[model samples]
Target chain A: MTDPKKTVSVKPDADQALKARNGRNIALALGLVAFVALVFVVTLVRLGANVGNRF
Target chain B: MAKPAVLSPDTPADTVRAARWQDYFQLLKPRVMSLVVFTAATGLVAARTHIHPLLGAVAVLCIAVGAGASGALNMWYDADIDAKMRRTRGRPVPAGLVEGSEAATLGVVLSLLSVLLMGMAINWLAAGLLAFTIVFYAVVYTMWLKRWTAQNIVIGGLAGALPPAIGWAAAAGDAPLNAWLMVLIIFLWTPPHFWALSLYISTDYAKAGVPMLPVVKGAKETRKQILLYSLVFIPVCLAPAATGLGGPLYLAVSALGGLVFLTLAWRVFRSDAGDAADPRVADRALYDVAEAPAAEAAPAVEGKRPPPVGGAKDARNLFAFSILYLFALFAALLAEAMIGIRALELPL
Candidate 1:
């Protein structure tokens, strides 16, 4: 049986664990975003899509 | 100020001051501020107004500072709802690094200072816009619309989209219809961009007692609205191409980007909203600030968590792409501006 006080208290590593997870999650998400952006840019370049030059 | 001998007078106060400074900065949401600055800079440059570079820089600074001030004030006021949301639980106010009252005071002071300086240094039109943006964000969006309606981000996007136009007006002395058209595009884009996120994080918003569209209308209704907004956004996004501001490059990218955006919106629209399927996937992929493994705790969140707190699978991905979408859209605008600059330099 755990002590009630101890049970309710958050572990010291809880914050650290949460932080690690957050960092990894953000990295993974950013990677996918970068990939999508890369694909979009490459596709535009390959197609000679000059959206930027028309104005 | 009397130095209290009892409160460790011998210890250098610089460390304490630095700690306090970091906390104050965090309250302003610096990451969001960076995006505001980039978009505003794009707006200013896109206007192609020939102002001294130094003055242009100053105008941009004022806009960024004003934006920061508004963010701080918002954090101060929304601390309650913020504390309840898992995504916001680690914000400076919720984390207890800064007192709510102090954050409010900093916000108000900075808001006043930023606006006054901008009016003096920049044109009143830009200054006026800056002033209104602060009020719209801090008073209208944060205090009222955020609580009263699901259409909050939709209407509230105007404030976020204003910085670039304000920056442009500061340089050009008047924001042209083109600048305003850019603003309109962002305004229309806000709903689909945000609602896709809301569809997944409906529970967190619900838990916080903020009656987001999904909470009041349910998942199917929210999904439908997301599609409706996307349909509206696609046509509006193309409007810039016909204007003096956009060209072939702008048109092509807008078309392609719009297609992708529409496809995602369609997927979200067609997905099952029934009880078994994890509806929170979009939000989980988008705003995964804490990044906990979705499969592990996601089921728990979906099943036991009330309608308001459950996060959908892939929500983090959706949240993330929303950021990218905004970035890409503005980058295209900057590219158009560059093209215009080159054209202006052409000798007949």
Candidate 2:
């Protein structure tokens, strides 16, 4: 006799849905981080070498 | 083996499938975006202005993103028509990979972000042009011209041609005659390029109720118009060299390539490319963007046409060459500017 709690059955569709959702979330996070890095680099380029030269 | 009790034959679609990030990316029409980026970069480089490299990169990115946004909007709006056509039925929206509302939202958000970023990081002129381009593509071309007129691509080509001018404006804060000359090259190139494609794939356009020249005005007229556009297009290709905008390489490429282009167009003019009442083998070859089973590959694409034995070769060749010709012409210009080759001003 197997314990029911030890062997949980998941719906196939539910499993696929969860996996796809996870993938999208990771991709979105990576995209946001890339956007932030790009903005930072662009800001630095626009500012040139002088940090305190202009207000 | 017993089927799982929880898993039924009829599952709700939302539960069975979820959208991926790549589907969202496909909404942007990356194939078209690539062309926009290339032309915009050429314009930026050809301007001879000293914009910072990072800023220039940002400008090009903004243009590409803006173009992509417009494509998303186009897909969102044209999903129904797209689903009816063989070439476009596999798109994210039409394929049910992504919702139309989601595509619309993505387009709207990206359009705003790209325009605002351009205004903040670059100059307002470039931003203004980018804004206009988005609106023009989404509203004027896609929403209005596409379904209403046989001359749809002729007018819609403006949206595609503006990127070069926008790039020039980004670098120099102004668009001069030379910049618009680049614009002219693409504007003129669009008709023949697309018309050659339409000549062979008129059946698809007809099924979708699209007012393509071949569908509305007949294949012979479409071929004639293609020749007319090519005649005008070739001279404009040569103009860059005479105007001191392009170097000797541009002249050689334009002259040789223009002759070949005209030859192809002439062959299309003489060929019975678009007169088929039935969908030809070329229609399958032309619009086989989807990986459907042998069942859907039947004639007419759900009543879709099958590939014919012969005669679409002329239109197909012209279509292929048009892409190469445009790419090569732009490549020559970019190469000349990158390598510091001097332009040869003709005695005119």
Candidate 3:
């Protein structure tokens, strides 16, 4: 198990592996987009709510 | 659904299928995450602080992700034992849907992400508590105590208990007595809830060589301990109302629910819950196990002596009811706080 070569690497050409890889890529993209959006929105809410109290 | 790549002797070493996204999600232990999210959200709301909904949502997400990270790490570490038991055999790493190294990587990555995001978006105190909870569960509980002591769940429960405290900190910028009261409820509740489960299914732990209370101390002692914990747990359930953490609704739920919980514990104590030989669940198919009448004579699986003619329904009742009772307790507090019900103040 310690040997990296022991566990099979993802066979990207196989149909199931190909589907899984595509699905994972899509999920990663969506998650990254969501994270970016969340950070932007949280920034707006925090800064906007506090803008009036800024010294 | 894709088949999980179970390796047969004939199967080549290098021909495993890629893990699906669902497997990755299962690695998060989403059912447990739901409980964490609910309790944490309730704590934030009960604090009655004027945090922006967005910030509150972010806090809950951070707590959920941190909890999921901890669970993934546990699955990674416990894969060997998990595979041996019927209960946890289907988990991603043990079932071969996800590799142990991948689970560890996901756990580490998510742990960092959740902690960083929490610190950036919420108070550093909340972030710090979340990080501590992850470490406590992953390292202290999973790596050290689980195998070492019968008091595993008792101490390890603090990891589960701290989420509400984290949520309270996120909202109020500090956790106070009332917040810790919430933690104490869960901490006290954990032993009875888990021990009741261990009563019926302890053979699984024994097979896996896990040092569960029942496995280590024997079922009779485990039952006695469960009752003892229940004795303490029920009163603590009522403490929130007296401590002003809960209101009329909370009081009603905790009181009425506490009575039923105690009665179940009493039944579990009086009954021969864990004394009989438990059913060999590993030999039975999942559907067979589900379809078999829990209280009736469970058919022997592969000549394995089934648990005494009638299974221990008292233990099962307490186990099932414990989940609902805890949910009701938290829901009452959340509802009371949200609906603006005043707490019952004593004129001492």
Candidate 4:
């Protein structure tokens, strides 16, 4: 049986890997935010053109 | 020398950690959101008026985001109970992949953004309905009804059933009779669909202190309720054809699908009752294992259960068929709408 109280320490290499993974995740989130903003801007421009045409 | 801190598998790390992108995505409940998007799109297409494709796409995106927002909020609030249940323990908040506070903040931000963007792009009516759907799922169902009563799914299904109407409103700027009929069909379908799942996983609800029908009222009564709801769902599904929203193909699909669903539900009811009547059978062993005291029987690890037979098989069959029934019915309606087929009149 394993000891319940033992602290499992991450190796330095493993810790570096985890940090790198997290950094990639942050970058992906930022990219998604940019895409959503682009969609919003395009939608606004199209709607504005439609309104202008109607008038 | 100071002893290192003891940590259980369930415990979060002491250090603050950046959430992985997958962790945030898991909070959105992507599977549920996919179903929401599909049903909403079907409703939009089935509407009488033609909407600009761009606006239609935006409306669908807004509804999807609103649904995801509700799912994230539900995960945040139910993290405690989710951690206790085997099926949900791997969820982001429960698994310590993401903080509950972070999930809650994401949910709130998404909810506001979706509703506001929808109102600006489409009409306020659809936006309002989307907002209400989020609140109903997050607050009414997750916070209130889930723990309070066994009738939770029966009432709380309204939120899930409203997306079609929201889609119709977005396209036509008003909900008509057909939209309401779609809502009614989904509302009636939810109890049986969810109850079938609950019958097999009642122990999870019991462990989590959730008042699912199977746990609160016992398996026999829950099975009977499943049958009763399926009986009601069949007619409601067929009603769309009568209102001219569906055509011959839609009517045929509903009839065949309803028959299959009802048969499976009946089999489940009989199997459950059979197990209850005789506890010595191997089928009863599985049921007993689920409800047995945690001390007596070790917690059955997820995905490790033996191949289900008898009542377990029946419940799983009904659950699977229920999803197909809804999909077939909606797909038929969508096809008829896109093709411009008129409803075929039957000889009285």
Candidate 5:
């Protein structure tokens, strides 16, 4: 019978891929934060006139 | 629902790591978070005499984080039992991608940070309630009542229902009767909502040695309890109309919803023990799985296994509908509030 230990192969290349994935994730997260901030600023600007009129 | 695990496959070798940030975001139970946010938002909105929108958003965010923290803590503590239960076996913790310690740490840190930030940003009343909610769910519900008693969900439900009141307190610095009315609606809603689920997964819970009502008591007893709780829930649900939170629209929808809910509960209660309730529910022998090893090992051949009663299909349909029932019921309330329809003066 084949060895059970060899059943799962976790290669070093997979680890390298994981590291690359992690880097991309960090960049993407920062980008999303920036986008959200930009949207929040825009919404505030758009709503400012209406809110001032209300006051 | 016993489909494939959401994250992990059977073979550990064939591990799929999602290369996106959204995948990590899914670790937070966003649907439950939304419900928490909605109820809290409704509370804050209702209580807004004159509050800044930014602070209100912060309050909602803190409540959302607190709810997420509780979910993470629950996943952390119940990881073992979750692995055994079919419904929860696919969760991140049980599926083995996320470590239990990591979940616990996230829960604890988030719990503290959310409450502390809320206290500093808002009033102390809301912060105190948030802190109590975290402890109640994580410590009381998760650590204590869950494994020990059939009444766990019934009593521990207050923790889940606190967010609205906490929101109200955040806005007004004091939760009055109207705020408590919101809490009561959810409190009464929990049993029928959860019991309907337990009706399906009684076997899984039994297998996991959780003393859920359906596991400890027979299905007949659980059904009777469901009917009893539902009878009480329907009236409490209408209390919002009296308390100025609901109007004609909410009253009409909630009354109709209550009738349907009662009908479903009655169906479950009336079902004979065997050859009923739907296919997903198999006939289970109600053994006291919570008792000590010595007590549980002794087989009570004398206590004959009751025949399965109730339409499992009916129960399953009711369980599914209960989720929508609560959602629709709350949506009606939101509709009424948004329309600015005031309640009639009820003859109390």
Candidate 6:
């Protein structure tokens, strides 16, 4: 028969892996957000001259 | 943010796993978003008003993001039913890949961002449509109509159908008659497309207790309704040509595709429910028999998984064709717009 204490002991490594994965995902998401923001800024700058001419 | 809990050095390795980034992405329903992007882009292009290319790209992106947001919110809210249904069991929330609350938070954040960006970059009208679409899908459809009515897809389809109108509004600052006509075609197409799928997968829905058309109306009525919707959908497909949105190319494709779509629906209607024999099964068995040596060949395995059966095959065929029909219709619209093709008009 398995010991209850031994069964409970397996959670720590799994918890650590979960934390690491979550951290990586959060970082990636932030990077994507920043990239989109950069694109928005560039587009505004590039199109500013055209906007004045068209209007 | 809270720090990770300190575990003893002897801690065991069986702890619960966290969701991967792909799991979170899957909550967005990227396949469905692709359809939204294509239809919306077609609408934008088909509009008489010209938009700056960069802004047009932004508008399409916002629409795609908004569609994704709606999908996430749907998965979050429908986690209960999703877990019960086999088809949706592996979805992020239901599969425990992402917490339901996390999905809801992502949905809300993306929804606000997409709408706000669209309003700033495009126009308020388009932004407003985007906001309404997200709410309609998340709250009106998923939370209310889906569980409450057998006509869920019929009504919920409006949310999916609105992207093209939103795109039109984004480009022209208002949707004209042609844009609305495109929306109507999608709205009519949705019932037949989804009901065909539901006919075969009714057992899954029955187990999930979702009150789909097949669950509530029975297969006979569902088939009849599918045929009716298909008949109605064909004329709507042709209407775009009369409105000058579709040219000769569009007319030809719509006419041929509509005929095939109607025929498949008719076949589905004629097939008896619960018929397990499929002609394809016989064809395959015959092929195997021809390939085998009489003395050395083993007898065919009995009770193997049967081929897709009578109504099931027709349902599957209709479902597959429905997707092709929509894509081809939209592609033709895109082609017409690009090439400056329009139907010839006769003076009355």
Top model number, TM-score = 3
CAPRI-style class, candidate 5? incorrect
Ranking by lDDT: 2, 3, 6, 4, 5, 1
DockQ of each: 0.02, 0.41, 0.40, 0.29, 0.21, 0.27
A1-55 per-residue lDDT for model 3 (tens digits): 3877575434543777778878988888898999999999988887885896785
Model 1 per-residue lDDT tens digits across residues B1-348:
112122222233322221234567777788879988998888888888786665677678778889999999998899888767767765666665566777788799878867876776667898899999999999999999999987888888889888878988988999888889878877877777677667666777888899888788888887788779878888877777666676666667778877877777776677643223343343343345455453445555545553422334333334455567767877887887766733121111
Candidate 6, B219: how far from true, in Å? 0.4
Query: Which tens-of-lDDT digit does each residue in B214-253 have in candidate 3?
Result: 8888888888888898899888888877777888888889
lDDT of 2 by residue, B14-65 (tens): 3325567777888999989999999999999988879999999999999999
Which ten residues in a row are the worst by lDDT in model 1 chain A? Answer: A5-14
TM-scores for every predicted model: 0.73, 0.87, 0.88, 0.83, 0.79, 0.84
Global local distance difference test of model 1: 0.71
Candidate 4: clashing pairs of residues: none
Question: What are the interface RMSDs of all the models?
Answer: 13.5, 6.1, 4.2, 4.2, 6.9, 4.1
Please report how far candidate 1 places residue B262 from its true position, in Å: 0.5
**B96-211, model 6: which lDDT tens digit per residue?**
65778888998999999899989887889999999999999999999999999999999999999998999999999998899998999999999998988777667767888899
Which candidate leads the pack in DockQ? 2
Which prediction has more favorable DockQ, 3 or 5?
3
Residues B74-186 of candidate 4 have per-residue lDDT tens digits of 98898888877766776777666577887899899999989998998788999999999999999999999998999999999999999899999999999988898999999
RMSD in order of candidates: 13.1, 6.9, 5.4, 6.5, 9.0, 7.2
lDDT for B206 in candidate 4 is: 84
C-alpha lDDT values of all predictions: 0.71, 0.84, 0.84, 0.80, 0.74, 0.81
